[model samples]
Target: MPEHRSATTPRPAAPGAAAPAAGRGGAPGRLLVRVRERIQETAEAVSLVLDAELPYAPGQFLTVRIPGGGARCYSLASSPHTGEPMRITVKRVPGGLGSGWVCDAVAPGDVLEVLPPAGAFTPGPGGLDRDLLLVAGGSGITPVLSLAKSALAAGRGRVALLYANRDPDSVIFREELRELAGEHPGRFTVLHWLESLQGLPTAAGLGAPLAPYAGREAWLCGPGPLMDAAGTALRAAGAEAGRIHRERYFSLGADVFAQPAAPEPPAEAGVEAGAEPAAEAEVELDGRTYRLPWRRGTPLLDVLLAAGAPAPYSCREGACSACCCRVLEGGVTMARNEVLDDADLADGYVLACQALPLTDRVRIGYA
Candidate 1:
């Protein structure tokens, strides 16, 4: 039997809020334990069970730390009312470091350090008493699944889910979702979008069924382009801005491969001796400019971290694209990059963690 763990500890009361005096016991640590790790579709996705109680709102996400690497944010696949043992279904992308590791190497009894839930994906009171429409692609179903389950448990019966996948085999949580829809009858409807399946619905084919729920709150998630397309269709059907929410999931080290090599220093700027500063160095981020003091062979990320810039980053090894930023001005050189593409590199994108300033000034976005 697996033991249960709390997904989140009780939060301290607000300043003017209720009881509990000082010297009372502090809160316990909130962590999720790996109770079960099973392969769902070989090399594609996996189903994981955490021995923790995650009382998460419908659209929040948890940042799971990959030991010796970095964190990967994932939406809770199970609803809060499901009781102890939270669940998350992860889909593996080709050569994706974190997703691949979770799907291949992670095992039972392994503990995953998880940060508290965060994000504005959760819907408010307005979402209740109205038809709920969800549009998801591939693994983007995670958060939507949670929302659907939570809505059902709360007795908000008017809900519909449109899930798109490459094929039937790649459809995640297929049985569970089917069961949920079956239990709810006419109150719940799930449409499958299979690119490879015969007679599957396409973007245009979905217009009719989704049109009726155009006034409903719509939640969209998945690949960037796919989400954009769905949003366009939903809006055209009359869904309002406030009623639609979109969330994007980026791989940890996807941007490193997008940077070009740094230009060589001028002849006068030779390699420094001892602790002397380099002759030419500068870094720019998010429309703001910062001079990189010529530190002798110092890692660029170290300098940025020391400067107190809230640079987006995960897996400093250039494997995750979390640190990727656009080079609005100058260029940079990369130490290593397994992410990114030729077009991205040509478009002036660079991974801050793996880049060193080769010019005097460079502009980028901390965003």
Candidate 2:
């Protein structure tokens, strides 16, 4: 029998790989994990392995807190079943505090605090028996790869990936993906769409390649446009909305695609005259109600968390809906949003990390 360690180990494994029967998931107050190692994946990406053993579903992400530098979320690229160090691949964002630190500063033995795994894209919605179509762009390959290994390993389902990158040298996990394909033979397939050779890859461009798996269930992660394009293409090819899942690395405010924020116009006189004062908030978590201080520039999630509320939040940047809550009364506005769609918006769901109250008093509930 393989020796089992006393603590959580995150190594590479398929999603279907077995894990310890019981383990503690690093909840909010317990986010500390020691960095075991850092493996360079590409010119811009590095994978960090943690010493702690925390069980998390595949496709979920951990909120990484850098002591005084605040927190950011990154999806776990390796499966929890590996019984090795838990691994999260970080792509260096040119000016990002979290990504920059992960890629440049973190090393063997370094420790970082990370919130528990949170996300809803894991397997079982359609079960592991159905065919799986994996789509990704740029660094978005992180979670898709995890999902791929999971689908393939879980039920021996056929898996195909359509990965888009800038050039041949830009792909993260290139060799590993190739090896997986080689190992799986007819069951796994991968195709690369390089911008240098074929221009930017879009959903419409995927029509021909995706035709074979038109009815297959798909999961996608990438920049906004890439995700939109892929989603459109998948829909055009007859994939049902129910069978497709999507997530973004950055919200529109953060610009996952690097599209610059438009220049702001000069402020006119009396700009504040009609501008309303900050909104007071009444937040409910687990049947407890607390009055929230609406700080001028603080995220609602931070406010709630600091107030001792078990406000679930990962990636306060508004991309992931880990902090999503039901709006009970009054109104709110998001600085940027990438998670909830029009229907969700109409239904009054808002990401607390991204939302700012618009009315004098806003009420939000976790349920």
After TM-score superposition, what is the CA distance of residue 226 in candidate 1 from its true location, in Å? 2.0
Candidate 2 residue lDDT tens string, 1-367: 0000000111111221212222233433335667878899888889987786665656667666654445566777886534445678888877777788778888997767655556555564445567888888877887777777766676667998999899998899999899889888999999899989988877678788877886887877777687788778888988887667776444323322121111222122224566445567787765578886565444577667566565655555666676667788998888877667776678787887777767767888764
Q: How accurate locally, in lDDT, is each candidate?
A: 0.59, 0.66
TM-scores for candidates 1 onward, in order: 0.59, 0.67
Residue 19 lDDT, candidate 2, scale 0-100: 23
Provide the lDDT at 91 for model 2. Answer: 85
lDDT for predicted candidate 1 compared with the true structure? 0.59
RMSD of each: 11.6, 10.3
TM-score of candidate 2 to 2 decimals = 0.67
